[model samples]
Target: MTAPVAHAPVPLQLKRGGGDAFIVEHSEEFVTLASTAPSPPGSTVEATHQGDAGPTTVRVKVRGCRRDPLPDGREGFRIDGRFVSLTRADRAALFGSQSEADPGSTSET
Candidate 1:
């Protein structure tokens, strides 16, 4: 398995009641979302990202929770969680596309 690669941060949205959304900074295996209140430890949250193919949802477990003060002078909680079940194809789409062959590898015909 390859190490987690760094990609540009994207906002992930979780559908909530009354047309509300939970925005999060999402990566391949991890996501961070802001909230006015902190969730209980070891809670499960689902984040969904809609791509050209379809909507990819990942089950995230809240492992680390803390209070964060935003630069805009907003106070809230930050939820840090890891993707519980991220598939290979979804990983490629979310993080980045992984090349099948190594570009640095040299081969003899």
Candidate 2:
């Protein structure tokens, strides 16, 4: 009898307008983060693979600034979402710790 093979998890990278960054790791899933403005509100962002598909909508509301203050008393941004898919490089950066492994480490689809 033949055995089934296991695949590694995927990694995600999110970049907001203000240079904010997010990293997510999952097997097969999607994520979305959306938020409203606060007079001069910013934006919400989510990162995903090129061809993967699924729900891609998120809604959020801006509350107040950060309690501890950020540099110039700027409040931190927040998002709500989930993981969808990750590219091979994203996977390595997240799971493999950016290590250089055998090219065959990743399975062919």
Candidate 3:
């Protein structure tokens, strides 16, 4: 079986506004995102990481977006995107590492 690529579900900066999303799943070519807010299609997403090492960025392009009902009876967004670029530090933050043993340490979906 192929091991899942380590993806850090960190907060992202939206073109118009900021919501939240998990790097729900990923591959070498793309990363799928699930957000708590709607992301406009054709927008660019940015994930920034800061630590002892410094800051880095993970950029993705929004391919599509949709709203889904949450279990709490609230609404959320499912944003599917493709990775445009990912720095090494960005990778470590998404996947687990000694620096960030728990990658997706951000807010819950």
Model 2 clash count equals: 7
Q: What are the per-model numbers of colliding residue pairs? A: 0, 7, 2
Candidate 3 residue lDDT tens string, 1-109: 3334544455453434564556667765577766666667798777554544565566778889888643334577766777786755566655645335445555556
Superior candidate under lDDT, 2 versus 3: 3
lDDT of 1 by residue, 13-67 (tens): 5543211124456654666666555656798766676777777775678878888
lDDT of candidates 1 onward, in order = 0.60, 0.32, 0.62
- Cα TM-score per model: 0.59, 0.28, 0.59
Ranking by lDDT: 3, 1, 2
Scanning candidate 3 in windows of ten residues, the lowest lDDT window is 1-10
Candidate 2 vs candidate 3, TM-score winner:
3
lDDT, residue 34, candidate 2: 23
By TM-score, is 1 or 2 better? 1
Worst 10 residues of 1 by lDDT: 15-24
lDDT of 2: 0.32
